[model samples]
Target: MISYVSRRLGTSLVLTVLVSMITFFLLSNSFDGVVRSILGTAATSATVQAKKAEMGMDRPVIVQYADWLFHAVRGDFGISYFTGQPVGTAVADHLTVTLSVVVTALLITTAISVVLGVLAASRGGVIDRLAQGASLFGYIVPNLLLAIGLVVVLAVELDWLPATGYTPFTENPGRWAASIVIPVIALTVGGVANLSAQIRGAMIGELRKDYVRTLRTRGLSPGSIVLRHALRNAAGPAFTVLSLEFIGMLGGALIIENVFALPGIGSYSFSAALQGDVPIIMGLSLFGVLFVVGVNLVVDVVNGWLNPKARIQ
Candidate 1:
């Protein structure tokens, strides 16, 4: 297991570095052009040159990427051009708000998916049809639509919840939870729908295996057969879906955040891109790359443990 983890970690680190380099170089190159287009006739060549030098854009792409990577290793994510604050510090301040909604969404998604998936697989007639219909609705509707619909019905018409903004849990946990509840629901609904469908598919596939027939002949309780025997075998695919969903929650979801006015890394990245804040954009992209790589590594390790045969392969 240790060997497996180490190998996967090494590979993930390399991928993270590559992603960071690509992101840095692309952003650095685009920054000048974007800034130029916006500045146009008002900008002088000398002023632009000076700005480039100041932003370290005068350096080669490799050197710029290396410098950023070095500072990142030391937990210095550079200063935000817009805010004049440490990028890491700004991200740290907002992480709690983002995580509150994301974690809640993940938990809800996982719990609801497991129950609905198992039920759908166990009962193939009306129950399966109902589960399929619900999953389809959640899967087919885009998150932006979901967010807008939720805000309209729940916040505008019903006045049951706030439509936007984040409150720190430290101040008032109840209100903080209340504020993010809609966002969480919007985020998790799609994930739960996808996960449940995958779980149902895996379960159905596992049920067709000869071993399941043998278990039935052994007179094992139907519950034990499904939960203990079938579920263990069916979980591999569902696990992948869960991992990808978690990684996605951390990085993207900008549309949802924008629609709901939720303060998160997603909105920060969006703003950074819009303003051509090279440093912040690079920093956020690097952070996202690391997060995704780390999540993938963890998923690989978990999958390895769950199926020892995979380790041998």
Candidate 2:
């Protein structure tokens, strides 16, 4: 298990480095454009040169990347070109908001998907059909559309939740939940649909295995056999689906954040890209790559725990 974890960590580290290098090079190649955007169209040639040199754009790409990576390892991402805020501070502020919605949605998705999936697999009649149908409907509907509909019904019409805005949980937990509910629902719908389907399929397959029959013959209760045995085996695939949903939620949060006018990394990154804020962009890019790598590592470890065979693989 230790060896397996080490290998996974090594792979994740390598992937993070490769992705950060590629992103740095791609952005560096466009340094002139970024500098121009920052300085404005009327800036003189010498002024641009001075600005570039000041920002270390005049340094070799590899040297700049090495320098950035060195600081980044110590959690110093420099200052945003546009906002003058430390990149790490800016990203962290927004990250909290994004994580609140995404993580809540993920927890809800997992619980609801598992219940629906297990029921559908075990019952296999009207319950199954309804679960499948709901899954299909969710899969068909785009998150943006659903978010709009939810805002109209729950926020605008019903006045039950806030349509747009965010409140820090530290400030008021009640308002925080109210502000985040719609966004979380929007993000969760598709995740629940996809993960529930995967879980149902896995559970069904696990139920049909010879071991299930043997367990039944030993007079184990149906609930015990399914919950303790079948579900455990089924969870391997479900975890994979859940991890993928987490990554998808991060991407989806970008649009959801804008629609709801929430402060999140997604919205911040979007504006940073538009303004050609190299420090902000580079910091966000590195964060995104590292976030994905870290999530994948967690998923691998969880999968290994669920299925010992996965550790060997």
Candidate 3:
């Protein structure tokens, strides 16, 4: 386990560094534009030069990356071009909302998918067909379309939830849930569909395996045979699918955040990109990449425990 963790950690570091390098270079292409955004279009040549020098933009791209990486490794991700606050501080402020949305969506998706999938697999008739139909609808529909439809129906027509804006849970729990409900549902639709299909298939396969029959013959109840024996075996791959869906949710949150006007990383990232706030953009982008990588590592660790054959050398 130690060896596996060490290897994954090393790989994650290498991948993160490479991603940071690429992000730096890509942002460098707009280095001049960022300066313009900072100083505005009317600045004199001397002013531009001074501003560039002040922000250390005059350095070679390689040196700037090294400096940024060094600071980043030390938890100093630099100051935002627009906010003027530390980039880490700015992200930290909005991180809570984004995390809350994704985490809520993940739990909801998991609960619904597992219930539907297991029921479909065990029953394998009308329930199975209904589950499949729902899965297809969710898997195929575009998130933007669904989000808009939801906002219009739930917020405009039904008058149950707000269409836009956010309410921090700390301030008002009921309002917080009301505000986030639409966006979370929109973000998790595909996740629920995909995960349910995976779980259904995994459970069916596990049910067909010889061990299931042995357990059944051993006088275990049907629910126990399925839930205890079949579900546990099915969970490893379902969990992997869920983790990948989580990464998808993170990416999807960007769009949902914008759609709902929530003050989360998605909104923050979109604004930063529009204004060419290099520090904020870099910080948000790297945060997302690392988040995905971290989730995958956790999944790998879990899989190793579940299936010992997957253990690292």
Candidate 4:
């Protein structure tokens, strides 16, 4: 298990560095227009050149990347040209909100997918068909549509929730939870649609195995056999699908945040891109890459423990 974790950690670190380097390279190259965005079209060439030199953009690309990486490692991700605030501070400010929504969405998706998947697999007949059909429909709808529709029906029409906004849990837990219902549902529905079907398929395959019948023959309860035995075998593939979903929550949040008027890393990244704020864009990108990799590492450790045979692979 230790070796498995170390291996996964090493791989994750390498991927993070590669992503950082690629992001830095792409951003650095596009920075010719960045100075203009920062200084305006009215600025003279000499002034722009001076600004570049002052900002160290004139340095060798590798050197620039090294310095940026060093500062980023120390939580000093430079200043956003558009916001005039430290890049780290800007991202940090919004990270909590973004994470709150994503984690909530994930928890909802997991609980729902597991139950629906297991039920559909175990029950078969109409339940199985309904679960599959629901999954297909959920997977097909765009999240943007889901957000707008939920807001209109639940928030605007029925007055059941706020139409568009966010309040921190620290301010008011009820309001915060209320504020996120539409967004969480939007994310959860799609995830449940996709993940539950995968779990159902995995579970169905597991249920047919010889050991499942043996457990039944030994007088094991159907629930025990399914939950303790079948679910574990089914979990491996479901977990793989869910990992991609987890990574996607960050990217998905951008659209959901926009439609809901929520302030989050997604909104920040969109603003950064619009303004050509290279530092903020790079900072957010790097942070996202690290977050995805970190989540995958934890998943790997959990998978290793759940199925020790997975460690060798």
Candidate 5:
């Protein structure tokens, strides 16, 4: 297991380096050329060169990537071009807000999926129909529409919560929770539907297995057989889906954040791209690459633990 984990980690590290190199060179050259072109020929060559040197544009592409990798290893992601703040500090601050929203959504979605999935699998007639209908509703509703509906219901009509903007958890935990609650729900509804579908399918398949039939013939209690034996085996596929969802939650939730006006790395990246803030965009991209790599590593370890056959393979 240890050796397998090490191999995965090594592969992830190498992939990250290659991705970083390609992204950095492309961005640096593009930005530098733009800057030089905009300044014109009469513009001070010395000043342009100085700015290039300052931004590490004057370095060889390999050297620049090496420097970036070294700083990234040290948890110093350099400084944001637009924000003028250290990239690490800026990302850390906004990331907390995003993390809170993502974690809350993940928990809520997990609860909804697991309970609904098990119930739907076990009680297949009208209950299964209703669950499938609800899942369809969730899957079809676009996130922007869901977010807007929540804002209208919770903020405009009822006035139960603030419309948007983030509150520091330390300053007022209650308001902080309230501010993000709607957004979390809006982000997680689709995830709940997808996960529930996967979980329900797995449970149904597990129920039809020979081992489960053997248990029934051996006079095992239905509840124990289903809850203890079936659930454990059924969860392997669901676990993989959920872990992949976790990684995607960080990078792919831009629309939800934009709808709610919650400042996060995704939103930050979006804004930076629009304005051609090359440094911030690059930093955000690098952050996402690392986040995905870390999540996949974790998922691999969990998968190995859940199925020993995976390790053997």
Candidate 6:
């Protein structure tokens, strides 16, 4: 297990570095524009050149990347070209809002998917058909459309929740929950659609194995057999689906945040891109890559725990 974890960790670190390097180079290609955006178009050519030298853009791309990476390791992501805010501070502030919604949606997705998947797999009739049908609808509908419909029904028409704008949880937990509900629902529908289907299929396969018949022959209760053995065996695939869902949710949050008027990393990144704020864009890229790598690591560890054979693999 220790070796498995070490290997996964090493691989994650390498991937993170590679992603950062690629992102840095890609964004560096537009450094002249970023500098001009920072210094303003009215600035003279010498002024722009001076700004580039001051910011070390005059150096080779590799050296600039190494310097940025060095500072980034210490949590200093430089300053935003437009806002003049520290990149780390800006990203961190918005990241909390994004995480609050995305993480809540993930928890809800997992619970609902598990219940629906287990029931559909075990019951195999009307319940199964209904679960599959619901999953199909969710899969087909885009999150943006779902979010708009939800806002119209739940907020504008019914007035059950806020239509837009975020309230910090520190200010009012209740309002914070209200602010995120529509966004979370929008994010969760597709995740549940994908994960529940995967879980149902995996559970069905697990339940058909010879060991399940033996467990029944030995008089194990249906619930006990399903929960203890079949579910545990099926969890590996579910976790894989969940990891993919998390990555998807992060991307979805970008659009959902804008739709709901939530001040999240998604909105921040979008504005940064429009303004050609390279530092903030690079900071967001690093955070996203690291976030994904970390989640993948967690999923691997959980898979290993649920299936010892996974550790060897």
Against the true structure, what is each candidate's TM-score? 0.91, 0.95, 0.97, 0.93, 0.91, 0.95
For candidate 4, lDDT tens digit of each residue in 1-313? 8888889988988998899899888878777689988888998989989999988899998999999889888888898787689987888889988989999999999998998999999999999888988898898999999899999999989999999889999999999999999999899888999899999999999999999999999999999999999998888889888998988887899999999988999887888888889888888988888888887887889888888888988
TM-score order, best first, reads 3, 2, 6, 4, 1, 5
The lDDT for every candidate, in the order shown, is 0.83, 0.92, 0.91, 0.89, 0.82, 0.92
Supply candidate 4's per-residue lDDT for 269. Answer: 80
Tens-digit lDDT track for model 6 on 138-193? 98999999999999999999999999999999999999999999999999999999
Candidate 3's TM-score: 0.97
Candidate 3: global Cα-lDDT? 0.91
| lDDT (10s digit) by residue, model 3, range 269-292 | 889999999888889989988998
| Regions of candidate 2 where Cα sits further than 4 Å from its true position | 305-308
Q: C-alpha displacement of 170 in model 1, angstroms? A: 1.3
Q: Between 4 and 6, whose TM-score is larger?
A: 6
TM-score of decoy 2: 0.95
lDDT for each residue of candidate 2 in 129-157, tens digit (9 for 90 to 100)? 99999899889999999999999999999
Better of 4 and 5 by lDDT: 4
lDDT of 1 by residue, 42-130 (tens): 89888777777877778888888888889889888898776788888787776666778888899999999988898899888988998
| Candidates in order: C-alpha RMSD to true structure | 2.3, 1.5, 1.2, 1.8, 2.6, 1.6
Model 6 regions more than 4 Å off: 305-313
Candidate 5 Cα misplacement greater than 4 A, ranges: 33-50
How far is 53's C-alpha from truth in model 4 (Å)? Answer: 1.4
Better of 1 and 2 by TM-score: 2
Clashing pairs in 6: none
Whichever of 4 and 6 has more lDDT, that candidate is 6
For model 1, which pairs clash? Answer: none
